[model samples]
Target chain A: MTRARPLITDLLGGLVVTAIGVAGFVESWRMPRFAERHADPFTVPGLTPGLLCAVLTVLGVALILRAMAGRGGAVAIPILEWPAGSAQRMIFTIASVFLYGFVLFGNVPFLIATGAFIFIFTIGAELLNADRELGLLPLGVGALVLAIVAAFAIRFIFVSVFLVRLPG
Target chain B: MDGFFQFLHAVVAIGLSADLFVVVWATLLGIVIGMIPGLTATLGVALVTTLTFTMEQNTAILVLICVYIGAIYGGGRTAILLNIPGTPANAASALDGFPLAKQGRAGEAMAVATTGSFLGSIVGMLGLAIIAPWLAEFALDFTSFEFFWLAVFGIVLCGQLTAMDDPLKGWIAGFFGLLVAMVGQESLHAYARFSYGISDLEGGFGLLPVLVGAFGCAEVFVVMRQEATHLVASKVGNVLGSALSSFRYAKTWLRSGAIGTFMGVVPGVGEDMGAWVSYAAAKRASKNPEEYGKGSTEGLLAAETGNNAAVPGALIPVLTLAIPGSAPAAVLLAAMIIHGLRPGPLIMITQADFFYSVVAMVFWASCAMLVLGLLLTRPLLYVLKVRREWLMGAIFVLCVVGSYAIAGRIFDVWVMIAFGLIGFLMRETGFPVAPMILGVVLGPILDNNLRRSLSISQGDPLQFVSRPISMVIAALVLAIILFSLPPVQRALGLVLSRLPSLSRKNGDA
Candidate 1:
């Protein structure tokens, strides 16, 4: 993409970092010192976190100033550089994940929730793949079978064998 | 002499027992995990740690150690067959290995990797056995001042090395982790700092949940976001023959093993650097440097050897000082504590036998990796072909359960998702996640020692720089920050640029 993408990221990220630093410092400073209990002054609970937040605030300012000077480079990790034309797919995945984790997981029965999640995720992802060979009906059939086996097998192993006591 | 017998006894005890079954299966599982493009050794070891919660202490450590060693070695298979490295440690292997595969020499590349990995593990095992006791003895002299400085030194050095181009972001992530650690109760007064009357916040974030989210859950998003990969080579030609002939590259593996072990000993640097530096070093010393990146066996061997050697090398600090040398080692250290075994300073005096048992575990795991890698080379290719569409759903499910299993708390699952999003954002913005995890691991050590030392010295800042060891560590931390500055780096680049010309002129004269 364009060089300006990282520049924008840096600008936004710098602001968030500064915000977190400022808020963290205020919270740390508000912590009790235990002076009333005759505790050691040097061992006050606020001292270490306050110092860390102050340092963080300085670094955040540096990042913002560097971005303002137009000196930040593009994202450097090669593995993290995602290819383009996948926005629709990404949105689908994230939405499905949020639905599963936030709404479905703890609210429904374990097997039903897990199996339905796997089925929907598989069918949805396969439909998004342009190179797919399977028809939709066949894909759904396969996904249903796979999801059932996986849900039962995982529940049996974790709950019966390892004895984890998984949530609803 | 006595140590040798202790090591020998430990080896035989494990060798003749039913633990051999556990060793092979754990290593095989590790190999499968590493062969998957999105699965990292850290995530593999962390998830397996959940499975070992009810296991006996030493047995649990044995299984984790096997998984750790096996996973690092297993990633080389993906590097050769597919262009993608299974784990970051095998990124260097992908350079020469994919080329070799394209040339119909994939079997040879796999053979070279297996032999090289085994040799590297042996060298690192020797280093661990010989050096750990002495290091533990030296650490006994460390007081709170030294520990405080040590903690700072780890964070700064790790941040600098992992993100040298952008040390500012690395340090920020580390400090943020430390701030996250401060949310729980303070040890001195037991007064919660940032809990805000929430009962769950008083307990702080669980390390496993954060780790699983950052590495495991984040990986699911990253995998689904990227374009899919394919395996390029299907033919497994004469693997055993190439395996026998790969022994001729002795000098390359030996050198790479030593280099990898050194990198592993450096906190937070880990196996990725071990592979890269070893590959570069091998290329420089090669008779035909042009052959590199064009299917050079020496380069592939060096990469594999270097990465595997770092495994045992990373263990030294974990056993001796309770400081992990890498991310996966960080999980192993946490697993040690969760299993009720303490590591640091007094290990040699109190837990010497257990230390020897760990070395034996490494040795057996390396052997298991070699045997399994050769026998299952063909069958394992099926694993790489599994569609990400079908696989990621199950993987995310495991991530949720793994996080929940640690404490049976639904809040931890929420923590996992939160960190997963944060980790995804951090990666998108070019911030490395290793330093953040290292920061989490070192947080308590830094906080505890910082307050304790200050109380002892009654707020005399001079005391931090007064003792010899503490002063030396402080100086090192200063030097790292100074050298990371733009001006200092520019100056060094200029000087380094001139050195090559100066050397050439001297040779001509």
Candidate 2:
């Protein structure tokens, strides 16, 4: 049994883009006609989606051709045989980011969250393939220092100076 | 005359005040940001622009100018130290710079790069001061049709110049970017094109998110996927010796600086093209063209000088015509607008003092770059010792925070992720990202201007060519497209080969 080519993904993406571009072109073409009907012009005059449709059609064709070409040569796709626990570590890193957004945005202070996020991700990744020379203590300290400095710097410069309001 | 004195007073006062300190600090920070693999000069300017929103207009302008100069200069560091260029502008540097590093002349290469960058910037500044007002007057004549052609020219030129192998790929990327820009609401009407009932999509893709995706996220993915390689850290030697060597090759310095400044003046063409074109031109004119990629001091100098000079050149259009010559300049234009400084025909009349102040800022920024470059050479060398994984991890955090911090919206974060994936795919498949970015940046301008021009003509298509500026721009665009054709290029090359008499005439003259 052979694995399926990523044709479904390609077709779905292409169809969606083509439909949107065509719809936009049609709507824009009728805009002037519609504007005349309504006392006030409902559309932007002279800016139709014809150019956009032509460009999109060309792009859609190119994408389909590329997808048909499929995966070529062994060197094209490098074999990345990861260490035993690297996948889990990678998942954890991505998860931490999601969690930070969901849980830590308003409740936890930025510096604390940043420091914790970096420390956790770094430690988790390192644990997969332990290196004795790279001590946890130094890594933790470095991450903390960098995170604290960056958080404060960003706050002071963007908020205090620029008056930008950032979420806690 | 009174206003002149006030401008002079403003410059002197600003120079002596803490504003100078802020400029220096911002320049240093920009250098660091540009020296990092995942951070670019555009991002550096955008980040700093937000930070300048509340400051005095002059101070803000000063800081932004410093960052622009420093970022362009700083990109050379990673290009020299590692084979990987820190920013796209430094890509040409890597061709000669990496070889120089391997041969253990990294310090000398860096020194030459710094000196060349400094000189190039100064020359560009001079051109800006002398030529910008006249150019601005020329730009004042540009109406809607001219602007439309200009935007199209920028996108096409970017595609032609930046694409390594396939110009078609570059154009495709650019078109894709234009398509992306078509998302959200149209500029004139509030009608959403492809929002698909999603409120978040209605706002369209943000510049910060798209930039972060293309530059920062794509870089992270590329680095992660690549096999880990070690760089041989070189010692920092006498930088002054390298600076002195630049003067020894005065011809190369002058030629490269001129090339850089010319490339910079063209709207939408940035420092990357400046560096590559200068390198190619230098190699072609060199006594030994064969030594180009093999640690040639002249090659490295040409690349560095052209890129740095392109920085000030890029600013001329933004200051004069309200047209950004580069992505970084676009961000700078936004910053200027945010500070209530409208850059157009009336700019010189309304804010002559501010214009002069910008010229002064450019001069000061170059000096700051030189000072900081000398001081930071040894210190920044330590960055090479950092582990790739550690650096990547930290950069990842910055990318996330940077994207989210721009607008306090989770939607932007998602946009960043989506675009990051797209950028990664584009890179993996050998599609140039620069064209995509150019398309996104110029899309609205093209759309708006094309519409306006048609409206002015009351739906007459011939109006596009009737205007003088538009005609010239259209002709140039057509010429560029024709030049890209193989037969036309071959014929042109043959004609060029028959120019020995022209060369001899020059020698005789």
Candidate 3:
């Protein structure tokens, strides 16, 4: 209905860009130019990154100025208010993804971790839906069946057909 | 003539090979993937790229091309049945497509879309087969300085074209991607520039993981954050009749296909723009323009054909110039590099028949799509009914596998997650991700060439302007920048507007 203001997001994003640019500039400047090896100044490893850093800093300042002037840029990230219970679902999904990739992966058995991830994620998503009536039994059973089929299919394709090695 | 006949022989051989089955199956899978709401053609191709790592290069390339063609054509299914586009390219189709569906002619609309896509692909294939090698031949004269300018031109033009409202944001995203590529050890010198002592960072971020994260994982997050909509279905019609009827408006097909192919050849301008522009042109030329938004088969055909034709259009630059014409083409370019099939000016001379093989692949993919798109329209629509809960879960699994399978490294998976988060945030803030992806793809080329050119010129900045090819490219880049300025554009518009009257007065004299 109403337009969400992007002022805060733009301001924050500009600051982040400016910070990254500054860091990039400093780190690039510190990099060895290896002048003794008779390398051309233009071919110095830091040249492109350093140039990009300066450009990024300038753009960030421009973004900040536009935001301060009340002109349209990134006003506000609507992450907080996509729909009822959306923010929670998004956060949950992201966390589950990270956990699957980082913590569970390489540490646990490949099939078990993948199967559990699919099952839990599916059930978790259904449980988090605010508008739906949660049916635990069907949801659990469905998640289980889908996860088994998916995990096996993935293994068959990647491990068998494609010959990619999955870690336990 | 000899080369052409050889090309035909190769095509015949490939046609009879077992890989034809791969093409058929990949097309069907691509259609199903395209019909899904959260899935995109770019992601489909990227996922397939990971899967193709172990296959023979030719078979792998065949599958990827089929998937690419199928997915782009298949997005029309949702655009017609639901008011939602399965991908950004299908957005234009949804305008007239949904109306046709609501009128209980959904099958007719699907049939028209399939026919339009087939015709568009045919036209684009012709362009690729004819024009691309010529362009590559011409580009053989390009020097280091010319390449530097071309790279900059690509980034700037891409930023401006993809995000008209905020070209600044697009430029920033593009530059950021370039910076990301600048990480790890330098190619010219072994100096570690941005690694900061992290061993994993030394190799830089692999393109596959970042792509999977940005397109795949980010999609998962975006989909999960929204409530799913219900699907609507319609009955069948004579597929041949609906397809043949599109020929009644042959002019629309020709115009739209031309526009789509041309748009595809332009570096970074892609199918979404092709569809929108073609739809607008068709509406403008129509005798009954009022029917455009209310179930006009011509409008639907224009959109579908334009987007699909752009597919070949996008590949033109990738095959000849090593610059991608679209996001999906970006992945395709990456796939080429992964398969050791380098695409650039030297490609024609080094691997002469590679160009013909690509053309053959496009031709086969289009034929496969025509068959599958018409026959399996309803079954593909059935995929739209699959719940978001299950689909997103499956996608996440694929993302994890696709990212890790590239290098069998866990860090790449983390990279995917990180980029996915960044992509999600960037999308929410209206920064276009395509330019950023291009930046990463082109960053090394830009850096290596710029340094080489400057080094060759002994740090003479004027060398960039003095060299003929570089000067021309530099002028084009400058022209693009100037035209992007509102004041300059207005002044140019004024001059252009007075030209007709001035011409008329001269004619009278």
Candidate 4:
């Protein structure tokens, strides 16, 4: 029964997906009536629910079969398991990327933001590995150099040559 | 004869100008990008595509073609040296190439790969020149039913071929990709399907963001989790000596070239499939099949030759039929359209000199690949010594920049990050990423054509079966599905094995 829980979970997942797909078909069927009132007649005429319904039906049938065959459960198979603390590192990385996009883009400028992102990320990766012997100075310097070189080269090509406008 | 002279004249004209220098430089830049892990041939082409938008059509075409050739060949370098394939197309190469590197024959492996690539490109070009018209005629016969089946077949085949141990994961991954492709407005009409009231989703997911996120950012996250800081470095050796050894396995080169061209002609399948199929076939045919994954030069040669050949092979459909055989070919087709050139049946009649000029471009691109590959071998080898952490980090930044620069939208950057997470999760599970990429690239084609065909048929379900070409394609699709069944495959294999022997005996008698 303990081993069977995974199979049950997969079955439930498949069922949920099928239900969603069926709901989509139903929703699409109702959409034309609503769209007709709000939208132009030219647009609503082409947005037929038949095609959407057919696609959903097909997908639902496929999913049901896959679940019945015990195939849906197989997607959870792990090739390489992440180490403990890896989740934290991934979260931090994602946060850093978001910061680099939102906060860094406008304030720090492109080259500086790019350099900082590289430097911080490399250091963070090293710290996550928990390798103290390597030290931060060399890695930081190397990353800065690489980031500068890359940023300038990209600017030269994309901006100077191609004349694409980049965020300063 | 006059056309031939004009062809030669165009070739000479381009060859003498700064356009030739641009081609050379582009080829070198492409090689550098390709040799680095996470920078793929597709990305190289896509990035260069935007740059070439401002240039003259002929010069743009030449630069892009040279880059395409150089990048495809360049991926083999990292595969042989670092054991991490620079692109998915090089995955098969890494199987035997890395083993050869470990055996202190890294230089030899690189050389063999280079020679095989050169030979393979030439063979593919010849095929393009000689058989493109006939092939295009055949392709024109393909309609909506055929395209839908082709897209499905590509996804299924890629999944089955890539995932050696499990096919289920492949299908799931592929379906997931299809679902992702479905998020935007339907192609037949601008009706939103899964926009969820979000204005940004109106355009659907951008290809550049999805690609960068999947391959680039995901790779960085995966690498960051690993314990190793630096890639294991191998001693470099004589590249020329290894190239000479490639000639010893001439049969492998020829076989792979044929396989590559065949795979490339099939719409939606590309260099990755070419490499996989060629590698598999070479292994099966070789006396030393067991040595394939253990650094056999034959395996490396087959993989490299197949992928490089696929570069020119992909262009055949684009030049002749106006239909792209692969994703990069689709971009190339778009570029052609932008240049006021429509490639189809009438192209040869309408623009005979332009047709010859494309042929000339391919030839020059091949020559450029050979020269750049040999000259840059030593310096490029040093790149393999870079720490994995640094390399991965640098690539992540490039991915961000590349994704953001595509549309200059913050939404695209977020999309990249989101897809990167999804790609990472998918990798942790058993899903193959190639099918997903294929789905995204081919989704609109399948959707638009299927809807158009149905409209033409007035919603008649049997319309696909009624058309002769569509009927043939439907039968082929059915045949492929039936062939995948174990019992059917075994029976077919038994029959196939006996036929060759019977034919040989009959010939001898």
Question: Best lDDT goes to which candidate?
Answer: 1
Positional deviation of residue B429's Cα in model 4 after best superposition, in angstroms: 2.5
Worst 10 residues of 4 chain A by lDDT: A40-49
Number of backbone-clashing residue pairs for each candidate, in the order shown: 0, 0, 6, 0
Residue lDDT tens for model 2, B227-279: 44456556867777777888888888788888898898787678999999999
- Chain A of candidate 4: what's the TM-score? 0.63
lDDT of 4 by residue, B1-509 (tens): 66557668878977888878887888887777678776677667765766776788788888778877887888888888778777777889999988888888877888888888888888787777667756656766676666655566666665565554555455555555665666667744466766778988978898768876776677767665545523444556687766777888888899999899877766546788889889999999999998889989899899998988887788876777555566566556656776677787666667767777877787777788877777667787766555555666566666766677667777887788788888876676556776676667666655666666666676676987777866766776667556655568789999999999999999999
Q: Name the candidate, 1 or 3, with the larger DockQ value.
A: 3
Candidate 1: global Cα-lDDT?
A: 0.88
Q: Each prediction's Cα lDDT score?
A: 0.88, 0.73, 0.86, 0.71
> Clashes in model 1: which pairs?
none
Rank by lDDT, descending? 1, 3, 2, 4
Q: Which ten residues in a row have the lowest lDDT in candidate 2 chain B?
A: B224-233
Q: TM-score for all predictions?
A: 0.96, 0.85, 0.95, 0.84
Better of 2 and 3 by TM-score: 3
**lDDT for each residue of candidate 1 in B120-220, tens digit (9 for 90 to 100):** 89888888998889899999999999999988888887787777678988888878877777878878888787889998888888889899888888888
Worst 10 residues of 1 chain B by lDDT: B156-165
Q: Compute DockQ for each candidate against the true complex.
A: 0.63, 0.23, 0.67, 0.33
| Residue ranges of candidate 2 with Cα displaced over 4 Å | A1-33, A36-48, A59-112, A125-132, A136-163, B1-13, B227-231, B392-394, B405-407, B485-509
Model 2: which docking level applies?
acceptable
